[model samples]
Target: MSQSIHTETSLPIEREVQAAIQGQRALAAYLATRFETQRIQIFDERNEAHQIELPTSALRLLVDILAELADGNAVRVVPVHAELTTQEAADLLNVSRPHLVKLLEAGELPFHRTGKHRRVRFADLMHYKGERDRSSEQALAELARQAQELGMGYE
Candidate 1:
């Protein structure tokens, strides 16, 4: 069995939606700053209140996720420590299972075998994806530069 865990949450509440729609700009401004707040308070339907404290970095990430949800974007939250099977990792990377297996076999991506199955860490997959994206961007930029130099007039 795979150790990966994925959670999908619904969009913000009505009040939150209204706030996001009306105050998106202000929200963006607030997020741009290094606001220092240690805890967040939640009020229940019974009018009871509770507080949860989090570190500054965690709060920042929470705010970022909330901002994205407020903007009507769906978000997937994956823990850094999660481990995914080959198929799950392949799906996340938008590649074929066979290709991912080949990558694993070639030692391009680090993985550990469980019996006959291979497991890849979510963090490692993300790191490899980032590097791959950066490399692709650089190659595209170089191609554009070459086209410009050759007066290809393809723009």
Candidate 2:
């Protein structure tokens, strides 16, 4: 699998599509609650009908993706073990490519060189992101505590 599986750009969902997604999402969630797997029929452009079976987990994932689309958020599904280029990882982190490189060099995030190009595993990046987020939260909590102790008008 390649990281290029993601959409190149986020596009606005049309009203009709959004409405259909909402309806389908509701039905999928309902089915997920009642069954371990679902049989779905799909129609092609030629009006030919095809049926397939999907697990409850897939239905739940579909519901979540639909929910994000409904909320106008771009969603990218990256496999945990997938390798990402520096630019792709940077985009996921919402940071610049140079910043991501800095993190890789500083060992804040781990990456392996692929013929002079760096590749970061999606799982490692996510782990690093989680740790960074927790550290930030802790630092903010400490700052709040200090402010309260000093009577800095911060509750």
Candidate 3:
């Protein structure tokens, strides 16, 4: 029997949605009612929009539709954290200081101050690691399939 492959795909968020998420409150609720995609769009009063893509059974075309309406605005999801040092977060992610800071500001990983220093939570680090691992596994699987098709399996 042929092996069954399950692939996960995500659509790119528009640029306008990200702005709306930052500027308007009413727009968020309005879009929530109008759109039924697995993901939700964040927006602010300034018409800025951003998107948070959720893995759901929504139609594959929803991403394109949203992009057309969003006008390019899309929100990036940041993880909420409790308390952990910047160095600690970086160590867990195996990245440099500058990159970690960029992630924090880009809304990829959220952090806060406990006394006078920045901190991230253990949970967030692990979650990010898991995401990375999943991607790695997917790539490896694809590579293996290609190798087998070429009449070459592992040595």
Best by TM-score: 2
> Against the true structure, candidate 1 has what lDDT?
0.80
Better of 1 and 2 by TM-score: 2
Each candidate's number of clashing pairs is 0, 0, 34
Candidate with the greatest lDDT versus the true structure: 2
- Model 2 residue pairs with clashes: none
Candidate 1 — worst ten consecutive residues by lDDT sum?
24-33
lDDT of 1 at 19: 69
List where candidate 1 sits over 4 angstroms from the true fold: 1-37, 71-73
- 1-155 per-residue lDDT for model 1 (tens digits): 65536565676777776666555554444444465646567799998999976566765576676677678766677778889999989998999999999999999999998898899999999999999999999999999999999999957
lDDT of 3 by residue, 28-55 (tens): 3334444444556779899899887754
- Using all chains and alpha carbons, the TM-scores for the candidates as numbered come to 0.74, 0.79, 0.39
List the candidate 3 regions with Cα displacement exceeding 4 Å. 1-82, 113-117, 151-155
Worst 10 residues of 2 by lDDT: 1-10
Candidate 2 residue 78 Cα shift, in angstroms, is 1.7
Query: What's the lDDT of the predicted structure labeled candidate 3?
Result: 0.62
